[model samples]
Target: MTSPILLTGGTGTLGRHVVPLLRDAGCEVRVLSRRAHQPVEGVQYATGDLLKGEGIESAVDGAEVVLHLAGDAKNDEVTTRNLVRVASQAGVRHVVYISVIAADRVPLGYFRAKLGAERAVSESGVPWTTLRAAQFHDLVLTVLGKMTKLPVVPAPGAVRLQPVDSREVAARLVELTLDKPAGLVPDLAGPKVYSMPDLVRSYLRVRGQRKPLVPVPMPGKVGRVYRAGGNLTLEGADLGERTWEDFLAERVR
Candidate 1:
């Protein structure tokens, strides 16, 4: 019998899409979660906390491939380090990591943590592949939804985002998880880029609401990076088919 594949972040936005695909591909899956869950057919739950370094050894045991999708705004490096250490000890064959576009270039705590996690995976002694993707449509929608609640939306000047569908990203990650390890694959981004105001306008249009948009200039090094498109993959990147408009059409309403 083939060993089961280990999956982290198995209950997250991306993981929800990945689990069914992996199951349909005829692979048994073990999902690591902080909370307990009843096992389903071909899928088992391993209770673990990557940040606290608890239950990882048992989670990784006997798994050949690990798809690490769990992450947070902070401490991703520490969590990934903990997972890789156990994965190495377990003699896991491959470690697949999903990161954000321009993780190294973006000057933020979250981006820095992601970059650190990438380093941990690469140096883990296990064969590895990392794919950087743009912000998910779900995340973008949440941000815009909050902004729309305000009387006047604050649009960060010169800030742009290419929001890709989480399902598309999940599909690509499943393919990578099933294939041989390939290091640092080309980035994946949404087909179209939209400015902050454009995104806000689109959201308003979808919701049939009108509100004034206040242009707010982003300042300092972080602002400079965003203005220069440090958070973007403009060239040599795999583009997802779903547009932000397509996502809004389906989700908002």
Candidate 2:
């Protein structure tokens, strides 16, 4: 029998793609889920909870690689610290963590928590790789849906973003697991950059909504940071193939 590869967040947006990628690579995949379900072909589900540390040790046991993709958006720092401790104690050979690009540059509490999580992963004695990626197109889609309902999109002024496909990000994570652990690889971005208003307008056009776009400055220091391109990648690295337009087209129609 082959030792399994433990994947946290196996049922999440990226997890849906990563499971198939690992399977195609001929690696036995074990996913940590809150509840056990009918296992998919070439995939096993183990009951685990990020908050309670339930079923983590058993899931990590005898696994060659542990992909730590499960972190709470509300409490990312605490959840990450807990996961790191468990991974270290389990003697996992390789720990791969997914982080947000420009986490340090953004003063948003969410980004701060992610940065704290990255620090935890780096400090852990186990070999680890942290892959930072830009905001996903799906996330942007959600934002567009919400903002379109309002009379104005409340577009942050001059905020630059490079949204990547979640699948591409997941594929990179799977590739990283196959190779030796490299610490803090260059950030991944989408094929192009778009401003907040531009994205909103594009979304509106695609949806055939004629809502007047009242572009307004985002409030607070975090909004200022976002306007300063807090979410963009300045360093060139891995660029995904999918564009926001591509995602928007499929969803709009």
Candidate 3:
């Protein structure tokens, strides 16, 4: 029988979906979080952090595989190194990491961090699979929360994104966790790519807020990549079923 599966970032967006699927598959699930929490039916929670490497060994102990999903998008490289060190020491077999698409292309800090994290995981000497996917529709919501106040929204004009559903991405991660570690996989993306201005407008319309959109050209090489469709997969590899519109309409509630 497979040992319990250890999932980092279990309280975050992707892990919220992944935990249930693991349970549905009859795999024992353990989650590492910094806060104390009550246990779910088939899940256990342990307090931890990716920065300081706290509560890591106890989290991975007795687990057959580690879904190393914990990391700040800003400092993912450091987090990945810490987790890899701990998981390597714990003698865990397989590790499945959720990374962003085109991490190597964009010159943004966060994307660079993700690329650094991927390198750390790959060099950890542990059996590992790193899967990169397009941004999630929820990312738009996050952007809105950060950029918009009430009636005004400032964002990039030509930014193109292929946003996938978090649940579907989580499903793919669960599949990777159970399979043999296959190294870096092809990009997973939404059925269609949409511009940022259009997507944000659609979101605002749905939320009953038709805020005036100020399309400012984001300043940097990363902004250039955003304008050049760096976030999209040209070969149309592993297209997930949800469109940006479909995601906003159905899942945003």
TM-score on alpha carbons, each prediction? 0.99, 0.95, 0.92
Q: How close is each model in CA RMSD to the real structure?
A: 0.7, 1.5, 1.8
Highest TM-score among the candidates is held by which one? 1
lDDT of 1 by residue, 75-192 (tens): 9999999999999999999999999999999888999999999999999999999999999999999999998999999999789999999999999999999999999999999999
Q: What digit string (tens of lDDT, one per residue) describes model 2 on residues 105-219?
A: 8887788889998998889888999999999898989878888888755776668888999989998999998888999998888998998888988988887887776667677
Scanning candidate 1 in windows of ten residues, the lowest lDDT window is: 1-10
User: Judged by lDDT against the true structure, how good is candidate 3?
Assistant: 0.84
Task: List the candidate 3 regions with Cα displacement exceeding 4 Å.
Answer: 145-150, 251-253
lDDT for each candidate structure: 0.96, 0.85, 0.84
**Candidate 2 residue-wise lDDT at 154:** 79
Which residues of candidate 1, in runs, are more than 4 Å off?
A: none
Worst 10 residues of 2 by lDDT: 151-160
By TM-score, the candidates rank as: 1, 2, 3
